[model samples]
Target: MPGPVFLRGDTVSMRTLERDDLDLLQKYRNHPEVRRLLGRVHPQNRDKVEQDFEGYMSNAVNLLACVEEDPVGFVALFDWNESSGHAELAYWVAPEHQGNGYASEAGELAVEYAFDERRCHRLDAGAHATNAASRALLEKLGFEEEGRRREHVFLDGEYVDTVLYGLLAHEWRD
Candidate 1:
């Protein structure tokens, strides 16, 4: 059977991420600028990427974002706590494709999926303090900044604070 459409926007569509996508997805994941903000801790080769992909895909609702035929990025609703109706959100677009708003569109779709389709009570997200673009995207999607963990992530030899954001289902708009 075909998979369901997890989310779709004007220019982007999201679907279940399959094993076949690992190679190209890994290329995007390895982009220095992309990994820098994603808080990647270690260098990732194909094997490492495949391993991580399997682990994540098996547990979460991860969707590959595509612009027609070309994969641009991905968005995910994971770390679910069914009892509490909560889950974490994550999204990223290829660094070269950053300016096209793919991340924002896909992220909005994921938020809708979490709140409307999944019936999640709340969704959480985090962004590095220095990543203003990502922070702005969350803000635009109706996520409110809830807190900040001072120097929470050690990356590239230094630590960076992670800004927390959350949106409650009742607070969401169509």
Candidate 2:
């Protein structure tokens, strides 16, 4: 079965998550390292993944980042408020694939899709205040810091601040 191709980068392509991709997705999403930064609201079990794949996916753009058919990461544009032309951006790369620019590549495509194709005026992303890597990536993608929410989420053992970032359509180069 063919999956929907939403956007393409130089080394990675972002495609809609398909039913056949559930197992492959589970492998990445359930990884301890990958899940640590996601601020996951629920466990990524087979049942929930399948359920979300079928229902929640329809409201947002959730794409897998693949390199020559091998899944390396994921980019999601969720919580879209069309009336406000805004959405939340999220992504995670496998432990082995970090520092390769795959996430940035996939993120560029997703942000383009959100601003250029989807006509969204703003895209929001938040990272654990301690996550320097994500903060750097967001900066590389032209996202500006909006503010920080102190002790916004409880993760691992204690609460972590949420560093908010935003990109506006007018600020997009393309």
Candidate 3:
């Protein structure tokens, strides 16, 4: 049998999100740099953290990225339906740890899990039009730009386009 969490790459370890991760998630979620890149929806307080934690724990496909005991990032296979054998993957890294290839490592691991372990045929990622770093990272990890939804999300008093990317299992040879 496979472990509860599958190891993806050497740089970081992938594991299931647990209740103990609430504090760490809230810390990164509230960081100024992270908020600027990802946008903050609500205050990451105790109540909000707890509520989010509940959803993560209940979601079977939720995955957390860690460096030893430190919570570095999170990757989740969201909006999954068995009949489709497909899932959308989303991830976020701590602001302080940006540009260290942590996100790419986390992403590679997520893709491996989706393909090799979960047997998923494809993985999809969506990034804001202005988020060049995110888009570049996804491309480097073998995700191809599928399309763009112009002005789909209204953020910061303006609508922004979202670029959709997809990576198939066969494309991730590395």
lDDT of 3 by residue, 14-72 (tens): 87776667777677778776765665766789788788667643664666777774667
Tens-place lDDT digits, model 1, residues 3-112: 34556789988877877777776776777888888998567799988888777667898788888757778787889999999999988888778889888889888888
TM-score (C-alpha) between model 2 and the true structure: 0.92
Model 1 misplacement above 4 A: 1-5
What C-alpha lDDT do the candidate models reach, one value each? 0.84, 0.86, 0.77
TM-score of candidate 3 on Cα atoms, chains taken together: 0.85
lDDT of 2 at 152: 92
**Which RMSD values do the candidates have, in order?**
2.3, 1.9, 3.3
Which whole-number lDDT from 0 to 100 does residue 165 have in model 1?
A: 99
lDDT of 3 at 3: 24
2 against 3, candidate with superior TM-score: 2
Lowest-sum lDDT 10-residue window in model 2: 1-10
Which residue runs of candidate 3 sit more than 4 Å off their true CA positions? 1-8
Off by over 4 Å in 2: 1-4
